[model samples]
Target chain A: DTAVSQTPKYLVTQMGNDKSIKCEQNLGHDTMYWYKQDSKKFLKIMFSYNNKELIINETVPNRFSPKSPDKAHLNLHINSLELGDSAVYFCASSDSRTGFGEQYFGPGTRLTVT
Target chain B: QQQVKQSPQSLIVQKGGISIINCAYENTAFDYFPWYQQFPGKGPALLIAIRPDVSEKKEGRFTISFNKSAKQFSLHIMDSQPGDSATYFCAASKGGGSTLGRLYFGRGTQLTVWP
Candidate 1:
């Protein structure tokens, strides 16, 4: 079984459209995060949730919202998608109890805004 | 501003040779440094990690050299093999507080090991 998984491995949409990416982890972790990787392979954190509570919110646009229903699930929704939003989104999970800083990432969802 | 900076955007090494990737960070509060390996079409996976308390940590063929004084760290791959070719990313994060488990990743280095 996959430790972390995301739905719609590849998504293609147009500008101004809205979409959502769903993530789940079976690793029994207390912390979950969303990260974006640009074309240049630069990864940046967008949001983080601990035990379904918002923890870290980076300087991202208001159009991007993250919702965590439970500790095992976190979803990201983007409104008025722009071409610049075209990138690979990754869902990661880590156990705060370990305090080892080892994050397990999902296979990633490649989103394309045309 | 980028918190972590990685050098050698790309690297090529022969099988059985040594492969090295370097990274630096500006945040002194970061205590945990981790290295991740990502293959094409797959998400990143933790390769190894180290803390500021130690200068070096090694696991199998992978080793992390941390220079806390210089705010720099490097990953070394010994006996490099074709199977080890992938993109490597160095990351740092503090242990606790509002930013707990928040990782600052460096630009990935694409490594290609030729057989």
Candidate 2:
């Protein structure tokens, strides 16, 4: 079984479209994070949620929003997607309550905005 | 800003040789350092980690050598094999009860082990 999983491994859409990427972790972790990997292969954290509470919000655009309905799921939604939004999005989970920050990552979703 | 800086965007090694990737961090508060390996069409997987308290850690053929004073760490892969060829990433996280899971990752180093 996959510990961390993401839906729609590949996403291709046009600009100005609204899209959402779903992520789920079955590892019973308390924290989930969303990251964007640019073409240069730099992994940058966009948002982090702990127990459905938004904790870290990087200097990301307001058009991108992350929602955590429950501890096991965190979904990312983008409004008016732009061509610059094309990148690889990865979801990770870690149980910070245990005092260790070892995160498990999902397969990643490649987003392409044309 | 790029908190972690990795060197040699790519490397090529022959089978049974050694491969080394180095990284450095500017934040002195970072105490936890971990290396990740990623293969094509897959996410990164944790390979090994070390804390500032220790100078080195080893797991099988992979070894992490750290220099706390210099804020530098390196991953060494011994007996390089073609199966071991992949992209390696060096990451660091804040320590001392701070936001622990916010890892600052390096650009990454792609290793090619030719048989």
Candidate 3:
């Protein structure tokens, strides 16, 4: 069983286009996060939501917005995507109840802004 | 402003050899450290984790050695096989506050195990 899953494993879009990526977790985790991995394989956290409430917002650009409709679902929407935005976006979740800090990640969505 | 720093951008190990990856963090509040392994076209999965209270943790061929004073941690893979080749990441997180449960990942080390 897949603990976390993301849609559109591969995304190709032109510059200035808007895009959205969907994520779902069946692990019943209370905290969800969005991470971006650059070409050099540097992973950085963008946003995090706990119990459907925004908790951590990193230094990400305002153009990227993360929405958590529910505890099990978190979506990312990018407005006016730029070439620098091209990277693999990963969605992850962890059970805040345990507080052990073990996160399960999704397959990742490779977004390419040409 | 990189919270976690990992060394050796790439590593090559032969079968039946030992592979070690090191990481350091400046956050004294970080109590949980975990190592993740990722393959091509796949997401990273937790291989092993260690708490600051413990100096070491071992699971099968994977082991995590942690030093609280130095805020440094390392992952050792014993008897690495060809299938063990992948990208390894070291991550740290604290317990409470707005940053709670947020993981700070390393740049990642690409391991190539030759059979």
> Which candidate wins on TM-score?
3
C-alpha RMSD of each candidate structure in angstroms: 1.1, 1.3, 1.0
Q: Candidate 2's residue-wise lDDT over B1-115, tens digit each? A: 7899998899999999999999999999886898999998888888999989999999999999999888899999999999998999999987433364688899999999999
List candidate 2 stretches off by more than 4 Å.
B96-100
Judged by lDDT against the true structure, how good is candidate 2? 0.91
TM-score winner between candidates 1 and 3: 3
Model 1 chain A poorest ten-residue lDDT run: A96-105
Q: What is the interface RMSD of candidate 2, in Å?
A: 1.8
| Candidate 2 lDDT tens digits, A26-103 | 999988999999888878999988889887899999999999999999999999999999999999998886544478
**Window of ten residues with lowest summed lDDT in model 2 chain A:** A94-103
TM-score, one value per model: 0.97, 0.97, 0.97
lDDT of each: 0.94, 0.91, 0.93
lDDT of 1 by residue, A12-81 (tens): 9999999999999999999999999999888888999999999999999999999999999999999999
Instruction: Indicate which candidate wins on lDDT.
Output: 1
